[model samples]
Target: MTNQDSKVLRRNLLAGSAAVLAAPAIVGTALAQDKVTWKVQSHWPKASGSFNDSLVALAKELDTRTGGRFKLETFGAGEIAKDREIYNIVRRGVVPMGTISPAYILGEAQAMGLFYGVPGTLRETWEMLQLTKNLGIEKLVNDELAPKGVVMKAEKAYPTEVVLRRKIASAADLGSLKIRSAGTMLEYLAAAGASPQQIAGPEIYQAISTGVVDGAHWGAAIGALSMKFWEVARFHMKPALGITNDAWIMNKAALDKLPADLKLQFLSLLEERYFLRSVEYLQQEAIALNTGKAKMNVEVVRWPDDVLKKFAEASTGILKKEEAKGEISAKGTKALIKLMTDLGYV
Candidate 1:
């Protein structure tokens, strides 16, 4: 074969090999006479790549791992319960498994949001994993789910940053600006002089577009892309404030009902799948937002060191004040700060 023909054949061979490597378990499972299936649901729409993409891959992985005997039929946001309702729905065993932002239900367990997104918390995936492992928060957090007949199997961090339509060159720019924020972030934004308005994630885009809100402090790249916030917001800020933890939880009753072997297999697969998909999610989001902004002509702004320092100082003070006021318990606040400090994030 000519050199060009040889290269084409080699490329095709590699692609074929990769497909087999990625899917060996599926082919094996199709041949199995005995197997089980799982019904998994999520609280995010299929359009958001992070939530749906992870679910789809997880389903495929489970199918492969169990030689097709175990499979997940996944549903996107609102297909089962509305986003806000997914947590209770899953906890009540309305669904076998449901993916959700555990932090969203902090009222149910005050520690949830603090563990989910403590300002100046984990930035990178590895650092996040380390914190989860070392802080003993993972078990404590998961235990809280057990009582609801849900077992939090996996958690992954998504970088959350501040995005503004108006340029924020310094702390002064935040003065009196009404920023859409949630939970602890509300305090952080307020400390910066931006009046934090409590709005649902879905409402942020319209609020910003219609001038109902000045800006939103939410997910870094993926959330920005999924919400199409860039269309209305001209500026994307750098130096992310923190990360949010999204979890995949299995209904404990459903898991208890599973055959022991299958349960173990599922747990193992869930863990691996979460780690793999989380990495892919962050990378994909980073690419999409970074490239998408250039195409859309949105300016990505980096805060000056002095500006970032001011934010950190003010946010730290706000956290301390809240802890003292019992807004967040002292134990929760101390544990979180200790974890962040140990991880070198603070």
Candidate 2:
């Protein structure tokens, strides 16, 4: 075929694929005979509580809903891919799919920080849901990731909380202690005057248990309870940080192999899981906090009004700084500012 003809055919193929993906997902149960099972590497460790269970639930539900024809076999953190490297692994087809935090890849894709979590700029789960679903955070992330040959469909968003070895009265106290953190929270912590270190998920427990770091912020109460961060750090801070550090990413080539009908069904499952997981984790956070207080002897510390004021000032500054990162980051920052204004936060 001529070069023009080849270009036309490729455009047609791409358009056809887009149509299939854009179709309103059919919510009914229908199975195909493809018999495809993709090995999925999880960013969460098997020992992690609901984090791992949530993945297990997805695998089982996918199997049952697809009549056992489409499924996922999950491997925990570092089993095949480290938490930070899951995106690269999934893109390279080392595994067809994996969980990754956009925060993990910001060194190269700073635009994704909008999806991972923007500390201080957003507050409350409802605010985040609004930003993601209505303010274009989700679509923006999907669009930016397309050129990189990876597709993100779901999320594992929860709070980025801190548990310190000792309590402090204000944000100024943060400067005296070293903390284990990651993503935008680490940036926020550092800007707020705390010494923050980016450590992998699995190593956080040991890091806190020993004197490597004074304390850490993983995922609020649930994340702390997952690895029992309470045992090492006796003080848990209240009013946890923003909910983020999550994206369910997959290899485009592997996703394209599925028949159109199954593809829609699979995407629907992910959307459903996102909604369910949001509620599940929120509930789990409350329960985990209770468990820490009653059974584990963890003291919950509520920062003073002045300390909250300090954090807000620092967080707003960081959000403004994010706008300088890139085009998508700026767009996200703009959307968040509008949302914050609408909510009377600014």
Candidate 3:
């Protein structure tokens, strides 16, 4: 064929191919949306509790709200992946989403943990919410997750309270006790005159029951109920040192594929659920504290102003050290301090 004829034939073929592909695109877009199955795992057990329960509930809500367009298959604690490995698993897309402790992975994203709990930093759940949204803490968390190919859908703060086998009302009371603490709480407790050790969530019950440690600090409402903490310790302290923040994370690639409206709806569901559950969970925990249904009998104690002041001082020192070590970004630290000052906590 002549050169001009050859070019004309190629153009016609390309047009026909484009039309064929466009037919399916139009049909698929009209069929509601693409159905995607995503697997989610949590750091908590399958049992109905905070971390795991929240994961399952969120998954169910997502499936329901999306009319089953998106399916999330959830694995309970240690079912498919261990709690400690959830971050790597989600990052690699082994699971599309999972529940993770931002603080637990601080070594990966130093600023992420600081956004959650930093003893004396955010004393209450309300303060935590404000700090998270104020400094764009949620976005900071999302940005950190991006490098790992994960995006945080929701972050929930566990109603915090310190648990001790013995009564501890003063900094002096802490000197004799060995405690199991995690993240910044470890350092804060250590500086508060207690010997603090780092331990995992699943190990706390056995660790305390066996006297492997004197006392351990975990969640107040959720931990108290899930671990049967009352059976192991005599006292459930009021106004725990700090709440544990767990993030519901999704694989960034997976999140990117959802319809734009679906993505917005899904995230809105998470935000609404986070606020509602936190309030309800704290209230449920209060009821549990009053009923005293925990396996072992225990008394509830409250930290005095003097001891709290000591804790705050120690926490401040730890925060400064973390900043010096470059574990927490200067930006995050400054934003946190500003929030604390505005709230009159600093």
Candidate 4:
């Protein structure tokens, strides 16, 4: 009875254990082989600026990191949905992800306007970065956006400047100008006596050329140059309107469905690229400014101190108006004001 039966029993147990251990590896391999391609719709065109360029680079990096198991196809503004519709498109899963300016969706959530770097608020890139990273603004923003079925994976910011076809040196000059802008800045500009219109990216060039609008607020120096804004507008206003920040968001359901390891890899890669691209943009802005002035012959105009003061006052008034509309807006605006005040920005 004894030795032969005992040896056979031991061999059978070991074989079963080996098969159990090997099963998971086989399953993992199969899962990895099942590829996924997500479409990312962006509010910026492919050649618009560094932000869009970074997005393109990220898509390629995603393919490399996942060994081509995961891929991202990015579409520029107006290709899938207009800039203002990106948020809803991602929410409805028409696309898995999008690059959106929270300000564009102010109608959906009044608080979102506060998240896009309140006009006349933090002008420095470092300050804006700190607000999103260290001041908890990112959490407040995500808290509001998540309920709408989108999750912000990363934040991208760039310096902003106003481009004008006609010369404007002071607040008084604004009264005669009609400008195109977005977010709360429109309110601020209107308060300063300019007629503000919300124009989509593709229309700005024609708007400036055909005399539909005298000027427009756009991304930093690099952004303007990339879009060839100088061709239509000769003046670039200095002391940027604000450091504009937008969220790179994903469909909550689609993101949650990713395998745990792939999810981690995706987020990690996005974060690293976001940081590197932000730094690159800062450098590019400087180069663009110099190039715009020297090579492109674009005029740089600085608003008078009194005029700038009025803009700050207008921004504050608009912020208070928005804060009064809803609890979320109130909380978000209060937090940002407190942060800026504490940091000596106000």
Candidate 5:
């Protein structure tokens, strides 16, 4: 791939997607000849490279596959709505669809965290995918979201890595340090005896630089590299927390209006590309680690087995509380425990 094309592939970690299409219909049935274009708002800047290109590619696929009867226009984060505002805009149909992290909507239902990234779980992308499927997470979250006028679909899954200015060699390394974090991971970090704070994305670089926070669990290598986290903190924690999952959040009513054949085509593309997107993030993450080390003098820390064991223990405590959150969370927790148990981590 060309350098520019490769850069596009290097920068996505928490990215996700879903699309919508509609045209005038005869008695509620979409007409195959009708042309329609819907707008998609990204959760990151155009500099996000592959995260942005992935959606553009999806849009192109939709256009080519449907012979131009369907099209989507893409916009970067904040062009259509602020990151936190994407769910509302997409649901209200102010924009047909937008990229979002389920992390932002834990209030909609705590079970949404199952999709976001439940700490103490396996870090591998495929293992997490299996957890999502086994728990019927898609059905659970969408069941809540659909009635609210939104439908969520994940296009890719990538790890949320951590960076710190200090050495992290064991469980003691986790003690009393303030870290910027969000979602359920906060609870896990707290359980590990670390202080987790909520800081705006734009402020994180400065927060670390000024000792406002010791570290942050943002995106993986490529994403943190994009944010220049290495300038302030060189240790990039390895064995990422886990691949965070969000979605191409779409207006449910608009998507429901899609023709059956066209709808099938959309789903076919989503299914076929699920694993591909995860692998892309994984490959790009590896490249990013090399780039950061060679060009930016970044360091990688592989959390030891004992520290990881303490984490698993702490994760179970938080998992029980997660189970108490609601019905779906309870079921999802059981699935997490069952899987983790089989893997000998719980």
Candidate 6:
């Protein structure tokens, strides 16, 4: 072989290697250009609490992690659809994703009440997470929810307290007052003689102020302060109504359209958000309670021991009624009861 032949062979080998290395970059750039953007609506209005802030942060993190190939546009309650309508809207693909409390949809599926944290069960976030993760409650819920065309990605549990326009020293007092509430909590309140009405979060202040309802079993301390619940309701009832779970769900069809890598990225971000935000919720709750009492003049009232016992009894009855509805409700109720029993709550 001549020197010219050797030099040509070396040049060809180098060119082939460069082409192989460039393939991935070329493909990646093309994929990047085909970016996806999804709209995510939350049940809570924008800036309603730290939880809402966390949603915004999740969107920004997803964008960064996906190299800007995937983006999320988030809207708070009433921005795109009413809070109760979000589940159907997401399922219909009107918007690709949304956050909601399963309890809000209990009318559609009685079993969904189990996912929202039973009125007298799952006292803490970790306990609820354990029931959902270790005890297979999460799988049960996803299996049920998937058939409806919406997929549950993550669940968030946060504590809530009751706010009242009129002071109540005992559970019996609740019966004399009309209260705004929903789900099993409403049922329990009714058993105690309270006239329980369903009211939207945005409407609670007006309802209480204008004598539409005497009080509300509303959101966490921070959320009530955000909505100025204290302006109408001066008393903040403690021993939290139970930590309820809010679901972050996506349109199954829309999620299926995501590339494999993007889907993994989205799920990973959700897990991160769940753990971090859980901690942030407690911190913000403390701040809200302190600020509400000091600056807002919102007084904390502890329910009497007898009243709590009565509430617990009523809660058990409501769970039994829900369990009797159907097989799905029964299965969910059994799982919850087992957890509560194990934790000595039952």
lDDT of all the models against the reference? 0.70, 0.80, 0.73, 0.80, 0.76, 0.79
Q: Total clashes, candidate 6?
A: 1
Model 4, span 1-346: residue lDDT tens: 6999999999999999999999999999887777889998888876688445677888888889889988998888889997878888899999999888777877765566666777888767777777676766667767877788888744567776888887776778888888889888787788777889999987887898899999887787876788888888879887887776767879999998998778888988876765677678889888888898898889888876766888888877877886897887787777778878987976
- What TM-score against the true fold does each predicted structure earn? 0.78, 0.87, 0.84, 0.91, 0.82, 0.88
CA deviation > 4 Å runs, candidate 1: 1-37, 304-310, 317-346
Better of 4 and 5 by lDDT: 4
* Ranking of predictions according to TM-score: 4, 6, 2, 3, 5, 1
Candidate 2 residue pairs in backbone clash: none
Q: How far in Å is the alpha carbon of 323 misplaced in model 6?
A: 3.1
**lDDT string, candidate 5, 88-178, tens digits:** 8888889888877787788886578787867767767887777766557767787887779988877677788889888776667787579
- Runs of candidate 4 with Cα error greater than 4 angstroms are 1-17
lDDT of 3 by residue, 274-300 (tens): 777767777877776766745346677
How far in Å is the alpha carbon of 166 misplaced in model 6? 1.8
Candidate 6, RMSD to the unseen true structure = 3.0
Which clashing pairs does model 6 show?
175-193
Off by over 4 Å in 6: 1-25, 107-110
lDDT at 310 for candidate 2?
66
| Model 3 misplacement above 4 A | 1-26, 29-33, 169-172, 259-261, 293-296, 304-306, 325-328
Clashes of each: 5, 0, 4, 0, 3, 1
lDDT of 1 by residue, 173-252 (tens): 76747878666677666665678787765567899999998878656777777778777786887777766677777778
